[model samples]
Target chain A: MSSTLRSFGAIPAQRLVRTLLLAMMALLAACGQSSEQVDDMVDFSPPSEGVSSAEKQPPASTGNALQVDVGGALAAAPALPPAASLDEVAEAANRTEPEPLSITIPGLDLNQVPVIASGVTATGEMEVPSPLEVGWYRYGPTPGEPGSAVLAGHIASEGVDGAFRYLERLKPGDQLSVAFNDGSVTNFVVDEVVDYAKSALPFDELFARSGTSQLALITCGGDFDAQARSYEDNLVVVASVVA
Target chain B: MKKFVSVFLGALLSVAFFVVPSSAQSDDARIHLIHGIPGVNVDVIVDGNVVFENFAFKDTQDLSSFAGQTLAGLKVNAAGTDTTAIDAGDVALPASGNYTVFAHLDADGAPALAVFENDTSTVAAGNGRLVVRHAAAAPAVDVKANGAVAFTNLANGQEAAADLAVGTISAEVVPTGADDPVVIGPADLPITEGNSLIVYATGSLDDGLEVITESIADLGPNPTVVNTGDSPIDAGVPVGAGLALVATALIGAGMIRRSQGITVDA
Candidate 1:
């Protein structure tokens, strides 16, 4: 064994092969640690300061005069018998369902793409819509509602390009609109585009319900892992409501 | 505690005209007012003004804008009449929280009031919260989800809660330890993700027992990951296979060199 080792050491070709093996092992180690390092650098910062400042605006009505007159009325009024039922009043007060129809991103050349209400799958991940459609996160606020509403789409599926294939191309100041079933359209301007590793996604900030009204468009990006058959990073584009 | 109902009403009357202190808190409290008293139409007065007129059974009003303010002289009167039925005086709404205030009946069939602070905490991903409140004039009961008792012996004026997966559940309320007479429903209730579905068992059991619901949304947790694509259309390179192939080639080359060296020595 010692003579074989001496012969192997004496050969320059064997020495070059050993150096190449060491380099390959180092490369493998770096690949394994890259995702963790990215996760450590993940920022959980809240929304922009300008958005939070708008929430401090004063309310329109104070109701001061009405507050003073409430005491005297209760003492003056006598107890009366229950009146006849009016079932119509209850029907008029029922809650209305949101009817989001389609999304339009002219910058991405996506025109009036249909949207469907999507929920989480059995494994707790957001269910992606079909290649040609966008999915609105029905559990969150609607597109025009006052919260962080999320919309997800496929970048590509089965070698075909999906609805959000050009989602990462969205830049700040870019415009988009979401049309509702009621014939109304809500416009939004792009705020920012971010790319996050799948393991380092800021769940709290991305899914927050209380904040300035905003919309999030998401798709897969970064390097593809063939063994896993998925992308390593998520591309997110955030847009604020246009006043 | 036999005078629980009157004592609670008296507390409201004493504080009906008191002023609320101003605070710098900016939390928004979402409040929903539900009229659960069956067979009666009423006008809901808040701070001396009739906010809801001719409010019938199961009628709901969003009082979220009134959060952080004192509802002085809050009263319910027979429709279009000055006769007061239930006066919840000077009720101070919380600065931040989801709440539901119901004008319901107690266990003894007397008209009463209930203020339920809803659970608005973050729900697990793909799951929702279900809250059951007994605001009816009835005995203790068992609340069932899909024909199985999820909450047992839930008495009037009490509540039970659970976090369930997002789906539709067939809900029914029955007497404790018995399933023959299903009281409330075999109704289909959709348990949506990141939202709380609060179901109130209201009215008199013998008169017209029914269920009213309020949904508080945006309580769902962010998904751990969003895998949108099954194939890589734009993913620049298939890095995993590339790295593995390079590593395999390097290892195989080294083995061939070592074997050649050993053969030369032999």
Candidate 2:
């Protein structure tokens, strides 16, 4: 045993003591260093936990690529059976619900004016549009669809005339056109113009969602009451889809 | 060995610090699963992964663990198996809104799935919103709240909603134009304040009948209530012409009722 240990003891005492002191100083330096530096010194292989993140999180697939276990074996379904293929798909794609983008009335000298899809006001009346623009009732139908699509515009706001200021001037056989988001234009022929009391505006016929396709152009008319801040009556131009 | 311990502690501390803020920003969509099909256990698969396993019939599961995301599709499969039952193909789940996925039969009495956009907007102080969805395989029917016809001729896949004072609500269903031999029931359901109660009628009269009522409370604030249709005017009505104004409003309301041929709720 003594002969075996002779090699380790053969080193000079001073050199051995210096070597131990150097090792202790290196350990203290490592302990004083930040964890970030320690991380750089260490090897960080990916975790050994079961599956990798890539295998766990697969990309979402479209349509019917689902696996169906049949008779203890996995089988992919070709596709789910179709349900009202055309209508459902169109509705799901938000296609069939058409929205008007602009309107043109040649009789009233109203060219393609932009339309904003507006809803009922806080007071429950139809919302009026901005100056030089028409307001399409969002609850109503598209111009070409089988229903009454209503559009309202301000007659005057702060002394400025609106796009539908002369809507009451249109007569029967006057041509009007409406453009939709799908770039389709629907032509209409003016049927008649009628003045209704603001309190008596026909709610249903002016905003039907189904039936023969029609359009109702509306604006404030009759006497203006400063106390009420509105006109006494509304002028509505009824038109039908002719083309 | 000391170096390894320090590196491990550093990595753990960094991970712990980063995880807190990321989880706090999570806005997961709320999903409600109603097993409406008769006698079949199901598993809900979202984006190719099974989220709910062994979901049984007439069971309602609120998926609190499902963090909302735009899923490719929501599929229903047989429990413990991969057989696809109903596929609501490629529907967008809003970032953080309540949704109910109805697995019911279509008009032709075939298994189908319909995703209805829920209106969780707040109700009045003492009122709750009740939305009745006719998802059954039966024909057009009338829904009665406390034995009074609230909705008429509601066809399959259509929904009608009304705001009601909070109380125990008794509801029944009958075939269109008939009153007796109730097809569904005179069942009682509780309506809580500031909540939205959705009742779905599933299954057919011949096979089976089931009702899945889901309630979500503490929506927000009351929606603005405004008078709609021909209400007797006092302020907005033109002054100095009461008789003429009344006549015009009556004539206009009558014409609307005749031409439109659909009841407008006042």
Q: State fnat for each of the candidate structures.
A: 0.25, 0.00
Question: Which residue runs of candidate 1 sit more than 4 Å off their true CA positions?
Answer: A1-138, A141-167, A171-215, A220-234, A239-243, B1-21, B43-54, B72-75, B80-84, B87-90, B224-266
lDDT of 1 by residue, B122-236 (tens): 7887788888889899999998899889999998777899999877788889999999598877876777767777777888878878776766777776666788777878444
lDDT of 1 by residue, A1-243 (tens): 222233234454354344334423332221222343223212111124422332343442223433344334333333322221222212322446655666778676665566788877656698777776788887778886777888898877666667787788899998888877666778889999999998787766776677778899888889888788888999999998888
Q: Which stretches of candidate 2 lie over 4 Å from their true place?
A: A1-243, B1-28, B46-49, B63-68, B220-266
> Evaluated with DockQ, which candidate comes out highest?
1
**What TM-score would every model get versus the actual structure?**
0.58, 0.38
DockQ of each: 0.10, 0.02
True contacts kept of 1: 0.25
lDDT of 2 at B142: 91
In candidate 2, what are the lDDT values of residues B1-266, reduced to their tens digit? 98556544433332222122112212445666566676677887764667666767666655322322223345778888878877654333222345565677766676676555577775655566888888788888898888799899988767889888767767789998789678887877565555677777877878877776666655423112111112122323222133234334544664211222112221
Error of 2 at B22 (Å): 13
Per-residue lDDT over A31-115 for candidate 2, one digit per residue giving the tens place of the 0 to 100 score: 2223443232221212342123223433431101221211011112121221221223223324345568767676565545667
lDDT, candidate 2, at B231: 17
Q: Give the 10-residue window scoring lowest on summed lDDT in candidate 2 chain B.
A: B222-231
TM-score of the first chain of model 1? 0.62
